[model samples]
Structures are given as C-alpha cells and as structure tokens.
Target: MNIAKPNSYRSGPDDRGHFGIFGGRFVAETLMPLILDLEKAYTEAKADPAFQAEMNGYLKNYVGRPSPLYFAERLTEHLGGARIYLKREELNHTGSHKVNNVLGQIMLARRMGKKRIIAETGAGQHGVATATLCARFGLECIVYMGAVDVERQQPNVIRMEMLGATVMPVQSGTRTLKDAMNEALRDWVTNVHNTFYCIGTVAGPHPYPTLVRDFQSIIGNETKAQMQEIEGRLPDSLVACIGGGSNAMGLFHPFLDDPSVEIFGVEAAGHGLTQLHAASIAGGRPGVLHGNRTYLLMDADGQIQDAHSISAGLDYPGIGPEHSWLHEVGRVNYLSATDDEALAAFQLLSKLEGIIPALEPAHAIAKVLELAPKRPRDHLMVVNLSGRGDKDVPQVGDILRGKSK
Candidate 1:
C-alpha cells in the first residue's frame, strides 16, 4: 500500500534515523523484519478512515476522550505569570493518558487476530491501562516491570493485578523500566506470531511512534479547541513531564506546527541536576533503546545507566524519539525538576489548586513555577496534568517524613 510521504515536518532523514535528529529505528536484527511490517501497516492505517473510526470509538467509549481542559485560575494567580490552564488528563479514564494509545493498540491487536497482549511499565500505569483495555476486549494480558519499580510503585502493581494482568517482575539489569522493557521485548520476540507489544510511549519501531502519537493527539486537539473557546486565542506555552515522552508528545504534537506556542519537557532530576540520583535532560546521551535511537543516560562504553527519580515512571534511561527530535529542532525546550521540587509541587497542587498530580506531572508543575514568574502575568500557559497522585502518596509521604516510623 502506497500513501503520501510524511510531510516535510514529520519524517526523519533518509540516511539519518531522526524525527529531525530525534527519531531513528535502531534495532536488533531479530526485530527488524517485524518492525518494517509494522511500519507499512501503520502507514496504511493512519491514512485509512476505517482504522481511524474504530480507534476513535474506543477513545470515546473505552478511554473517555475529550477529557476536560480546565482553567486553573488560582494556580495561575499563584504562579504570578501568564495565565495557566491544565489539560486534566488525570481525569481521563484509567486515571491517566495511557488508555488512549493502548486502546488504539489493543484494537490493532484484534485486527491482527492477536490473542494476547504484552507490555512493560515503570509505575505500572501503562500496564494497568493495557490490562483494562484487554479486559474490555477479552484478550489475555501480561505486564513486565522491574522488581525495583514493582516494589516502589506497590499501588500500581496491585492495580494491574486487580485488572487481571499477570505482573512479571524483572530481576535483572538495574531492575527498572529499561530492564523491564528488555524483558517485554524478549516476550514479544518469543510470541511474535500471536502477541501484541503495547509500548507506553511515542517510541519503539516505526509504526509505534506514529501510531501512539495519532491516538494520544486528542489531548492537544481538545486543548486547542478549548483554549480558543475560552481565551479567543492560542496558548502561549505548553508543558508536560517526560518519562518515555508519550504524554508530552500527545500534548505537544498538535502544536508542533504552531511555532508561536512555546513548549517544555520537564525531566525528573531526582535530587539535583548534577547529583548522582538524577535523570535530568542532559544526563542522557544520544543512543538506541528498544527499536529507536534516542537520548539515553548511557555511559561512553554505551551501556545503559540506571535512572533515578522519586517518580518510577520517569526513571527510565531514555526518552521517545519524537521528543528527542523536538528538542533538537528547537521546537521543544527540555528542562529538569528535582525530587524535592516535584514533591513540593505535588502537595502544592493538592492544597492550592485542589488537583493532586502524579509525581511525573508534578515535575512539569515544578517547571511551571520557574516559568510562570518569568512570563507576563496574563500570558496563557497550559500544563498536562498527566495522572492522579493517589498512587504516589505513600512513597512521597515516607520521603517527606524521612524513613518509616
């Protein structure tokens, strides 16, 4: 099937793997053929309304699309910068933005006649979302997560289990997201004929980065419409926390062509940017993970390093290629927020804005604190409240209180 080439702004280089120097399909030989197959299918599917309609139905009925784009008046006033609003993705069904992309993949799995779903998670939100979609569609689901993440994010682990997923704890490698992803890829290669790999971010092989973006783009679509209705103009800036960068991409993709809209991605700087316990933006060097070549916190020897953050979801060694692309193109600014700052924002939003954001989104909030005061008080800024904070309370409380009593 032949479709129009990716418009100039979207495709990577011919020889260079890039989403403008951010995306390239770098993979092991074993997965290359399947990755190419997925690329063809996604190219065709993206241009087909039948495929779009089916996924759109799931977004509306299964994942609850059109999540409210809320104007956080008090939050804006408190920031003392341009007026700020929150795309309340935390209100989306399944409590975060994961369901949107998962719904699309689960549907594609059914289309491919796949009977099982396999996925990886850090905080397990993506795992839970995938499991929920499988349960809705009557497919078997399995989730692989690092043993460390399973222990740190106990609540999400329980949530995934309750949703009928078998949570497989990976014990090898640093026992975190990257390791968990490695385990999931092994499962996918082993079960390639009848299993679907539901990636959590706008990453992985060709089809994955494109497919996930198309699904989650509803976030930005709604934000644009809502902003126009209320403000009679576009937002001046956009911000989201980056784990593997799905949420950030979803919120940023629609505005990519709108150069006037400033964008920022806040990475988790666990302690401080210069400290050992951090996953700051600059901490990672450009490298390949899974199927895509992107920025990763890897050593000169090219071994992936263990990433650290109070937010397990943000504790990955790399980010999505699209995000890497955006940063390199100068369309998106990458920043960092320390653990203390994120924790403070988590509580601050709860107390001041009555919106308790997940640790990941709270990192974006921390950046907002830095950015708001620097912009005009009336400038319009939008932050993606990616998920709810209930899952983070126990761990955050322990950190605040200094060890268990």
Candidate 2:
C-alpha cells in the first residue's frame, strides 16, 4: 500500500507520516482495500454529530469514562521523588483500558451493519473487552489468541468464552502475540466484507491508530482536569507501556505539544536490551509491516522478527506509527526494562500498594522506581495504570518460581 493518503482520522499523523518520518500505511495488497474502507468509515463516523453523541454516551455510561486521576500518597512517600499519581484505568470495567476502544469499534460496527465482530488479543484483556462489548451489543464475536497466551492467561480466555464470543487458539510462529496478529489478518482477509476487525491496540492499519487513540484519549482528558484540581498544573511527566502503543497514545497524545510535560514509553526488554529475547525499540531499525510504516524488528530482507516478553501484552516487534514518529522527533522517549526488572516492580506494587497491575503496566512501575528517586519529591508523575493483574497472577507466579533466585 502507498504511504500517502488523504484520510485525517489518525490524529497528528503526518502527510508524509513519520511523526517525524516514522508513520505511514504499510500492509498487504488484499488488506489495503479494507483498510482504506475502514479509514473512510472512521473519518465519516468521527465527523458525524449523531455518531459522536452515541459514542460519548456509551463511553460515559457503559465503559465508565473519566476514570480518576488518583494521587498515590503512600507510593509517593516510598519513591521520595516525584509526587506520584496514577490514572487508574485498572478500575475500568473488564479490568483494563481495553473497554474504551472496544466500545468505539462496536459502535462503528453497528453503524456499518456488520454481522460479526472479530478481534486479536495478547494478554486477553482486549479479547475479553471485545467479547463483553459484543455481548452488550448482541453481535456475534470471535477472538483470535495465540495458543501460548491462551494457555498462560486462561482466566481471560475463559472470560471471553463466557461472554458469548468464540475463542480461536492460534498455533504458529512461537504461538505468541505476533502469531496471533498474523492469524487475525488472515481472518480479516477471509471475512472482510461482513466482519469488523476490532484490533485491541493502536498498531494496525490507518484508521485504527487514529480510532483507538481518540477513544482512549479519555485518559488524558480526565487526567487534565484531575491534575488541575489537585496539583493545580500539568504534570511534570507521563509514563505508560507501549504495546502496540494504545494506552501510551491515549495518555500521551493530549500532552504531546504541551512542551513542559515529559513523556516516557516503556517497552518490554524481556531478558535485557542486549539479549536475543529483547523487544527494545532502541535496538530496532525503522521498517514497515502489519499495515503501517513504523519501526519494526526486521532482518536483512525485512521479514518481521519474533518477539518475546514476560508480559504477553508487550510481546510484539513493531509499535504504532505515531509512537515511532514521537520517538524520532523527541516528543517521547521510548525506553526499555528487562522482564526481571518489570517482574520485580510487579511484586513491589502488589505488595506495597495492594494494586497488582497488569504486566504491561509493571514496566512503567519499574521505570517509575528507577526515575522517581532522581527527580524532586514534588514533581508530578502520572503513570497510566493500563490494566489490572487478575489475568497475570498465574504467569507472575510461574515467572517468580522459575527465577530460582
């Protein structure tokens, strides 16, 4: 697919796309037509007044938008650096920020008269969220999951099934998140006409990055007001994990041009940045695949690399185009934390704050502890609590036992 297109649905994506030479539509031929169609539909839907009103209503009443921007008093005292605050997306229904995007996609599906809603997930939070929205809307739903993730994150797999959505276990390419994405693309190809592919994150074709960001931007919008109420000014920093970049984009987009608020995107480094298992952005070269032009882990011939992370949600080679752009332009700093570090932070937050965060957010926790101690104690730091840990307890247990520390 060509990089230059005329759709404006994706916010801040450049005419040449590369937030600073980092983003553009990159995908297979069969899927291009559908991706473009989605772009048009999304552009129109976003512009329509009635559609906007309906989406707003669902966000407010159904998915419970405007989640609190809470002060972490105890966590702050422990870190003794930045005055810590958390945008508690973990409190959202279905236990993550995934519901926000699902609601928007389902509404678009309804408007399009689509008969079925299909989605791809990693940690299964997005799968469960999609299934829940499908159930609420009375639409048929199917979720494609990697066999590895399905087995490791069983609670979420079962939750999807119980929500009346069929769960298809994908078995290919390490049986992880990337494999699941390949399967999802195939499914979209086979049933493009009647089915709507509700990609769980911001990493997909053109409109998806734009669509998911707008829906999830409720995070920043709510935080803006919440911060004003307490701290009386914008935060000094905002941090979130960058799996396909949805939660990060949601929380970071509004603050992009603010100039004062520093933004950090923590990627899963797996074993470590130099290790073979790492998925660090700094270790990767810029390339395009899976629908958009962005930084992907590709070898000599541009074949995408397989990714590994203790957090299934963070196991992917490429990030959303917008993130790639932001990284290049210095609007955002994309950093990495090894799995061991993230796991350590996971245990720390659960034990210290009584909040067991999703593994993806644990990356942020690790970074917060790493950076917070260096900053002034009064500097405001807003960490996007992307999801809860109910789905991760089992995996966390296994990883902790396997460490043999």
* Best prediction by lDDT: 2
Q: Which tens-of-lDDT digit does each residue in 1-405 have in candidate 2?
A: 234532332357644333546556767787778777777788899889999898888877887777888788888889888988989999998999999999988988888889798988999999999999999989999898999889889999999999999999999887888788888889888888898999988877677777888888889888888999987899999999877889999999888768788999999888877664435377787777777777788778988777878888998888888887676656688888888888889898898788999999999989999888899977899999999999988777876787432
Give all TM-scores, in the order shown: 0.94, 0.94
Clashing pairs in 1: 18-23, 19-23, 22-325, 81-377, 82-379
Q: In model 2, which runs have C-alpha deviations exceeding 4 angstroms?
A: 1-11, 15-20, 278-280, 402-405
Model 2 TM-score, all chains together: 0.94
Error of 2 at 210 (Å): 1.3
Across 1-405, the per-residue lDDT of candidate 1 in tens digits comes to 132334444444344345755566766777777677666666677787999888877777767778888878888888787788999999878899998888878877777778989999988889989989888888999999999999888999998888889999999999998899999999988877778889998878676887788788889999999999999999999999998889988888888878689989998888776774445357876787788878888778998777888889898878888777666656679998888899889988999888889999999999999999899977999999999988888888887788841
